[model samples]
Target: MLHYFFKIYLKLTGWKATGPVPKDLKKFIMVVGPHTSSSDVFMGFAFRSVLKLKHIKFIAKQELFKPPFGFLFRQAGGVPVDRFNKNNFVDQVAEMFIQNESFAIALSPEGTRKKVDRLRTGFYHIAKKANVPIVMLAFDFEHKEFRFAPLFFTTDDEAADYNKILTFFTSVKGKNPELGLEHLLN
Candidate 1:
């Protein structure tokens, strides 16, 4: 019911997903990039629904789990995580992949809505630690499309891997173009 509703909603809004869908994989990290606006949450939900990926989950800063919008985030499959604290986040999340037969978490590589000098490394580390593939999901607001790059397993070379990730997202335009990840391309 909700899936069909969102499917129609996306179609009506002229938003569609491009590239391949990971239907076979049971566990992996879905990296959604150029998260320049909060509206990306709704689009993320719409894409999750339209893709029929029920296991897709997200993590937000613990602050967002507070009053008012907190309940909404929780209802949207959000798990509040402490961003400031190291707290062995990578190991903890990696353990989750080990325990669950099927788990997929979508994370914003930018780590914040505002523009940054470089992309965060947590998502890559999580994928490496969990021994799962990384799938790129770009919110290309310029083209009004959600783009997916083919899933790829992480290698021992971190810098080279990040280069690949940046290459895939360089052309994507976020809702707030100025706040997007284009700067990282330099």
Candidate 2:
């Protein structure tokens, strides 16, 4: 019922989804991109509903799970992560993935809605350590579409891998003007 509602909401809002739906869903890291607004979460939720993804989870700050919002986060398939604990979060998530073969975690490489120069590398490390593909999903408000790109295989050359990611984002239109990567090309 909730999923159907979200689907309807997405359609009403003129959001179209593109690309092939993932078939080999053993385990993966769903990397959402160009996250510049809270609306991105709504779009992602709608995509998850329309995709009918199962056993998928996303990371959130531990504080969101501390009080009145904890239940809401859990209900939304959020995994509370303590970023300040100094523990190796990527390794911890990788271990979790190894332990649960069906886990599919979503991560926003931007790490925030504000503009950032570089993406966080935690997703890459986690995907590499877990030996799972990184599924790239982008929300392009200008195109009014949600595009899913091919799964990324993490290689030893982190910079090269990031360049591929940047290229993918470059192909996506409607990126928030403030979050634009014009500086990356210079």
Candidate 3:
């Protein structure tokens, strides 16, 4: 399977995965951070595959569904969405969780590879609204490792939860270090 192959690839490349494997991660939001390069896609895929996560999905733009890699993307659980249209993307994704027996959506808080003043809070809102936990995944290029924080579920105070999430990312290093979190809350 692709999962085994990716695991081998990660091992050969000197990258190791470390985190707690939840018994039931079925319906949760995976907030992947420091998405600074196209390489993040491959790395993320390998990471998920190596972890053998089930029903892990990413809500990507519909445009990415075109061309030669479309099949591959779908195979990787890429859910295509019309990003340009003014639709309720969060609700749409939340519905996926409701419809599926098990679903996990991996999304970037930064939204794009370019530098940003702060991360978008959609990931947190999605998890909160959907009544699911947020799994914080970090690509620490400095340490040459992939790290996952303990499962996070938001409480009544969003600020407290956000601060806790930020603390976990403090030591994370992205492929493009310069572009990663110069001001994560600006």
- Candidate with top lDDT is 1
Clashing pairs in 3: none
Residue range with the least summed lDDT across 10 consecutive positions in model 3: 17-26
Which sections of candidate 2 miss by over 4 Å?
84-86
- Name the lDDT value of residue 26 in candidate 1: 95
What TM-score would each prediction reach against the true structure?
A: 0.88, 0.90, 0.88
RMSD in angstroms between candidate 2 and the native structure over all alpha carbons:
1.9
Residue lDDT tens for model 2, 35-110: 7787788778888887787467988778999777689899989988777876789977888889985888888888
- Candidate 3 structure quality by residue, lDDT tens digits, 32-56: 8788888998898888777777568
Question: Candidate 1 has which clashing residue pairs, if any?
Answer: none
